[model samples]
Target: MARGSYGRGVTSTRTDRWLRLDGTTNTRDLGGLPTVDGGTTVRGRVLRSDNLQTLSEVDVRRLVEDLRLREVVDLRSTAEVLLEGRGPLRAVPGVRHRHFTLLPERGHHTDVFAVEEADAPELPAGWAESILPRQVAEDDQEETPAVRSYLGYLAHRPENVVAALRALAGDGSPDGGGATVVHCAAGKDRTGVVVAFALAVAGVPDEEIVADYALTAEVIDDLVAKLASSPTYAEDMQRRDVASHTPRAETMRRLLELLHERHGGPRGWLTVHGFGPGEQDALRARLRDQQPG
Candidate 1:
């Protein structure tokens, strides 16, 4: 667990992949991912992370000075932020913070699972029971936990989800900026979906997207423990085993397909949701780097 070392088990050649912040294990740069057009994602432009509430003084300096972070797209619900208050980064002058609740207030904690329980009647008895704070009587159907959770994101709050991307693509920060950090409480579920879409739009292939999504798995145990330690996520943790909460690559894979089949892929979905030609071009320019010769 050296600084910049992303734990022991996982391996990658992504040179700037993990940020190694003292407060969070899940922070990573969405850079150096291979795009379909033979280019790579621009290094230091987009970073994703869990909560920043505990970022050490050194961590804040690294983000501001080292990473040149300018915009922070916070995807947590109003309740989550109000409960946690502003993290250290909130008061910083150089960084611009934007709050876009990816989930409606009603669906903040239990309501997300409530929607999942209703739509996913096929979960195994024990898992379905564990779906919410209370047990859900199971039916004989099957869906992975990651897929179910993603579906809940789409089902519950698709509008804010699209808006979050649009904000990341634009340059309307307190300071005009491109280096944006997208994050939620854990930076796994809601942040994963939004970042997945951003990468897809940048022409990063499906496999790479899945790899980035699955990277969260490496730190799942520690993330769960961190969440469980807080009252904000304690009840959510009590709902299931930590293993069930770990992310799987296939979860993102299936979600990509769902976007393709249902919303006509990333470009079409964004277009339909009002990310017009101007915004699209701006986003690509902001994220895409020239192909290394």
Candidate 2:
């Protein structure tokens, strides 16, 4: 469907940036962002959303029939998916579902989406442990919990991180229509990191990327409430307030800074992790819009 043709709950905020669904608060098109070369990201090609387990029938229909969803890039851990089960979208025939757990496999599930796994194994030598509690105390706790959690994406699972980006870049889409919806438990961390890398590859400015990340702050309350209402996430959410899990614009800011300064930006990071020129071009093609006549 055309962008404006989306159903009633779709809000007018930020020029149709959000895909407001009754079941999800964080779903939105990763399109129309200004690129470095004076272009815009293609609309309806790439979407980012939260957990799809609670989607209503209407919501699923809208996503399938209207959005032309071609694939789903689920970044949740194995344990989380096993505990929560496949969501409403699992039954859709045309859409492809590819699961790539971004974190290490564990026997028990934790709120990995909201916070870093405290029991996660130590990083290999040379990977910064800036997010660990010991590092936090040594540094006077200068790093916010959110920033540490974001950094952990790099420290703990760089290989899976690269794979997740490849999956989003059309590796999982058979036809390359680009209507891929990527989500995790909260759709803000793993989703955010992968989306950030995708946007950076498309040459979207850091500010715009940060803006998109902060958009989650708009519906955080309702999003948290929805997750809390579900049996899968409610118990864990009760232990913490929504604000602690809320996305802050600054968190993304710091992440981008780290990406540029440490990993040499998205392209550098991807190249180091085994995504070559062909992979990069494919991702760019999926996100960038054609010039108008």
Candidate 3:
């Protein structure tokens, strides 16, 4: 599965640059997103994670120097920063850290993909069970707070999304144009949407962009397991299929379909968010198979 050998394929030439301790299980280098263009994202150039609050010393070393990540962006909400503290990025010396909150008032669900409990065929409509649909559902949010909030973020918060793209592309950073990463709580929905947009901008086909999108469920099976056993968890996953725990494949597919149907694919979506040709190009530069970095 992609989780086991994530960066291994690209790391033979490079080292474990983005590998970090204290980061969430879903955190990993986006360099593995295979492209028709031949190369993948350069290792250490960009990474995604829940929050760097608990990053260990080794994690710091990998991020600060090994990855040489020049920029660190916090896509979490303001409350999250207060609770989690993105922490002064010690690794990756002089790493220009920035905070661009995507969902400021609402606390982002950190582990929506923790599907271990979703193993239960009829999991209760608890907060824990809301991760996937809240993100990918096409229905309007009338009763479900999680669903409403997540969907509202997408429809109303184009600015944050745009800012995120600009940041990932380093629209105004000092990295001199290089690799970048984006993530929100689970690194599935918000992060996935952004990455798909970048990939679409890079001329990657929807089939592959979706392939990359579907991989997040596999990325965090362990966390879902943990959440399942803990009494703190809302429901028991009860051994259902793996895909059931994350956003339903059909749910995600429908969201992509909506993006295409409404905005004419990723580019049109970006344009609706006010992404001009220049910003679109910036996104392309960041995610498009690099010319050997």
Q: Best lDDT goes to which candidate? A: 2
Give the top-scoring candidate (TM-score). 2
The reply for model 2, stretches above 4 Å from the true place, is: 1-15, 107-142, 171-175, 290-293
Clashing residue pairs in candidate 3 are: 64-91, 64-92, 117-237, 119-237, 119-240, 120-237
Pairs in clash, predicted candidate 2: 45-178
lDDT of 3 by residue, 1-293 (tens): 01111222232222242353554556667555555555454444567665455556776666666666666666654433343333546335467656555553433433221223233233333434322323434556432443345455576567777777777777533243544546555566667666666666666555555556655565557656644543434255555544555744444455556566667766887887798777776656565533312
- Estimate the overall C-alpha local distance difference test score of candidate 1: 0.71
Instruction: Rank by lDDT, highest first.
Output: 2, 1, 3
Query: Candidate 2's residue-wise lDDT over 1-293, tens digit each?
Result: 00111123322238488887878878999877877677788888888999988889999889888988878888876556655665788778788777766664433323333333345433332222222332233432467777776666666667777876777777423336638899988889889988988888777777777778878888888888888887667876788998887888779887777667766776787888897667777777778743211
**Residue 94, model 3: Cα distance from true site in angstroms:** 1.3
RMSD of 3: 9.7
Clashes of 2: 1
- Compared to the true structure, candidate 1 yields what TM-score? 0.79
Task: Using TM-score, rank the candidates from best to worst.
Answer: 2, 1, 3
